[model samples]
Target chain A: MKEKLYRAGDIFSRSVGLILFFILWEAAPRLGWVRSTYLAPPSRVFGALWLLALRGELARHALISLRRVMLGLLVSVAVGVVLGLFIGYFRRIDRILDLLFQAFRQMSAFALFPVFILLFGLGELSKTIIIFWASLWPVLLNTSSGVKNVDPVLIRSAKSMGASKAFIFINIIIPAAAPEIFTGIRLGGSYCVMAVVAAEMIGASSGLGYLVLYSEETFNVPEMYGGIVGLAILGIGLNWILHRAEKYFTSWKEV
Target chain B: MAKIQARGVNREFQIRNTLGRKERLKVLEGFDLDINEGEFLSLLGPSGCGKSTFLSILAGLDKYDGGDILVDGRQLQERSFSRGIVFQSYALLPWRTVIKNLEVGLEIRHIPKHERRRTARQYLELVGLAAFENQYPHQLSGGMKQRIAIARVLAYQPDLLLMDEPFAALDAQTRENLQIELLRIWETDKKTIVFVTHSIDEAILMSDRVAFMSARPGHIKEIIEIDLPRPRTEDIRNSAEFAKIRKNLWGMLQDEVLKVQSYGGYL
Candidate 1:
C-alpha cells in the first residue's frame, strides 16, 4: 500500500511541470503577456479541437496520416529485415553492399523530396516513399548488427547438436537478434510518423500536417494548434502501440 | 577400438599484431589422443593452451588446418548429434525455458513433440531441475544454468560428450557439488567424455586419465591415470591418494603456466 501511494506521488510530481506549463499558457494570453491572435490559449485550442471533432475533420486528417505511416512502415520493415538478414549472415553480401547502404543512410529523406516528387508526382506514392526512405535505415542497420552479433557460442552449441543451417538461422539467429531488431522497428516507427507529417506539409492537400499548415495560412491559429495537438496524440498513440508490441515480443528478456 | 581418435591435429589462427600485421598464431600442433569408449578423460592445461580449441575441433564446431579426428572409424568433418558439447559458459538459449532448452537438440533431429517433451523432462529430472522447467536461463544461477546445459546435451542422448571447462565459472561449493553430480550422472551411462579444464584438483577428482597440456601451441605433454576408487566423493579431495596425484599433476603444470606467463600468452 505504501508502494502504491509512493508511485502515485511520483506520477503527481512528474506531472507538476506539465500542469504549470498549461496554466501559464492559459494565463499568458488572457493577461496579454502574449498576443491571443498569435498564440491561442490552451482553452481556445482545446475548444478548436472539440469543434474539429464535431465536424469530423480531426478524424479524417488523422486517419489519412495514420494510413500513410502504416503503409510506409510496413514496407520498410519487410525490405529492411529481409535484406538485413542476408547482409548480416553473408559476409560477401555485407562487403558488397555495406558501403553503399552507409552512404544512402546518411542522406536525409527530406533532402531527397525533390527527387521523389519528380519521379512519383507528389501523390500518395511519393509521400509513402518518403516515409519508407526515412525509416528504412534504422531497421536495416540495427537488424544487421543484431544478427551479426549473435553469440558465437550459441551457434556453436546449436551446430554441435547437428542443427542444420536453416534450423539455426530460423531458431537461433533470428530469436537472438530479435531484441535489437525490435529496437530498430520502434525507432523506424517514430521516423515513419515524423516523415509522413513532413511529407504531408511539403505537398499534400490532406493530413494533419496539411491541416496545420492550411489553418496557419488562413489565420486560423486555434485550428492550427488543434492540428498540432492532433499530431501529438497520433505520435504518442503509435509509440504506445509499438511499446506494447516490443514488450510482448521480448517478454523473455530480463526486466 | 577407440570411440574417438585424434592424429597430429594442427590449428592456426591468423590474427593481426599490434602493428596491424597479420601473423599466424599456432593454437594447437600435433595434438594426438585416443578416447576409449565409456572412459572419462580430462585435458588439463593453463589459459591460452588451446585445449578448448582441440575440444571445439572434436565437437566439429571448429576446423583444424591439419590432421584427423576420427569418431567411430569416420573422419570428423562437421557436427553430429552423436557428439554433444557442454561449454563453460553454459550457453543455454536465454529465450527458451529450461524445458525448451533441453528440447533443442531433439528438435534438430526432428523428434516428435511428445517424445521430445518426455525426454526433456527425463533429463531435467536427472539434473534435479524439473522444478525449473518453466524458468528461463537468465533467471537461474550459474550452477543451475550449467546443470541445464548438461541436461540439454543429455536429452539428445549423444554417444560422446565433449565438455569444455563446464564448471569453471561456478563458485567453489557449486563446482564441487556439480562435480559430484556429474560423476553420478556419468556413472549411470558411462558415456565417453573428454572434459577440459585448467584446475588440477578438478582434473584429479573427475577423470580416469588427465591429459596434462603444455602452453603456446598446445599439445598433450603427459597423460596421468587417476587410480582413485569410485564412486568418488567430496572427501576424496583430502585423501592421500588424491593429493599425491594432484601434487604430481601440479608439478608438471607449473612449468607450462610459467612458460605462458613469461611469454605473455594469456589470450
Candidate 2:
C-alpha cells in the first residue's frame, strides 16, 4: 500500500510541470497576453484535433506517414544487419569498404535529397529512400562494432567445445551482439521518424508532415498545431513500441 | 600410454613494437610433460608464466609453433567434444539460463533436445544448484557461476577437463568450498583434468601432481607428486602434509615470482 501511494505521488510530481504549462497556455489567450490568431490556445489546438479526427483526415495522413516509416525502417534493418555482419566478421571486407562507407556517412541525408529527387522523382519511393538512407548508417555502424567487440573469451569457449563455425556465428556471436544491435535499431527508429517527416515536408501530397505544412500555408494555425501534436504522438508511440521490443529481447540483461 | 604427451612444445607471438617493427615474443619453449590417463594434474606457476597458454594448446584452442600433443596415441589436431574447458571468468552465455548454458555443448554436438535437457538437469543437480536451473548466469553469485561453469563442461561428459584458474576470482572461503566440491566430483568420475592455477594451496589440495612452471618463456621447472589421499576436504588444508607441500612449492616458485617482479611484473 505504501509503495503504491509512493508511485502515485511520483506520477503526480512528474506531471505537475506539464499541467502548469497547459494552464498557462490556456490562460494566456483568454487574458489576451498573445493574439489567439497568432498562437492558438491549447483548447483551440485540441478542438482542431477533434474536428480533423471526425473528418477522418488525421487518421489518413497518420497512417500514410506510419506506413512510410515502417517500410523504410524494415528495409534498412534487413540490408544493414546483413551487410554489417559481413563487414564485422571479415577484416578483409571491412578494410575494403571502410573508407567508402565513412565518406557516405559523413554526407547529410537532407543535402542528398535533391539528388534522390532527380534520380527517383518526387514520389513515395524517393521519400522512403530518404528515410532509409538516414536510418541505415546507425544500424550498420552499431552492428559492425557490436560484432567486432564480441567477447573473444566467449568465442574461444565455444571453439573449445568443438562448435562449428556456423553454429558459433548463429548462437554465440548473434546473441552476444544483440544488445548493441537493438541499440542501433532504436536509434534507427528515431531517425526514421525524423527523416520521414522531413521528406514528406519537402515533397509529398499526404502525411502528418504534409498536413502540418499545408495547414500553415492556409493560415489554419490551430490545425497546424494539431498536426504538430499528432506528429509528437506518432514519434512517442513509435519510440515506445521499439523500447518495448528491445526490453523483450534483451530481458536477460541485468538492470 | 599417456592420455596426453607434450613433446618439446614451443609457442611464440609476434607483436609490433613502439617503432612498428615486428618482434617475436616467446611464451613457451621446450615445454614437455606427460599426463597419464585419468590423472589430475595442476599446472602451477606465477602470473604470465604461460601455464594457461600451455593448457589452451592442450585444449586445442591454440596452436604451438613446434610440438606434438598426443591424445590417446594420436596426434592432437583440433578441438573435439572429447575435451571440455572451464575458464576463470566462467564464460557462461549471459542470455541463456543455467540449464540452457549446460545444454550449449550438447546442442553443438547435435544431441536430441530431450536427452540434452535430461543431462543438463543432472549436471545442475550434481553442482547442487537444481533450484537455479531457470536463473540466468548474471543473477547468480560468483561462486554459483563457477559451479555452473564446471557443470556446463561436465554435462558434455568429456574424457578430459581443462580448467584455467576456474576458482581464482572467488573469495577465499568460496574458493575453498569449490576446491572441496571439485575434488568430490573428480573422485566419482576420475576424468583426466589439467587444472591451471597460481595458488600453492590449490595446487596441492586438488591434483595428483603439480607441474611447477618457470617464468616466460615457460617450461616445467619440476613436477612434484602430490600423494595426498583421495576425497580430500577443507580440513586437508590444515594438515601437516599440506603445509610441507605448500612450503616446498613456494620455495620452488619464489625465484620465478621474483624474476617476474624484477622484470616489472607480468609481460
Tell me how each candidate scores on DockQ against the true complex: 0.84, 0.86
- Per residue, candidate 1 scores C-alpha lDDT tens digits across A1-255 of 999999999999999999999999999999999999999999999999999999998999999999999999999999999989888999788888889999999999989999999999988899999999999999999899899999999999999999999999999999999999989999999999889878999878999999999999999999999999898898889989998998998899998
Model 2 lDDT per residue over A62-153, tens place:
99999999999999999999999889899789988888888887778888899999999999889999999988998998888889999999
Model 1 score (lDDT): 0.92
In model 1, what lDDT does residue A219 have?
Answer: 100
Q: Which candidate tops DockQ?
A: 2
What's the lDDT for all of these models? 0.92, 0.92
Candidate 1 chain A, poorest ten consecutive residues by summed lDDT: A194-203
Q: Which candidate is the best by TM-score?
A: 1
lDDT of 2 by residue, B1-267 (tens): 889898999999998877899999889999999999999999998788899999899888888999778999999968588989999999999999999999999999999999999999999999999999999998999999999999999999999999999998999989999999998899997999999999888899999999999999899989999888887888888999999989988888998989988887743
Candidate 2 DockQ vs. native: 0.86
- Model 2 per-residue lDDT at B180: 90
True contacts kept of each: 0.84, 0.88
Q: After best superposition, candidate 1 residue A255: deviation in angstroms?
A: 0.8
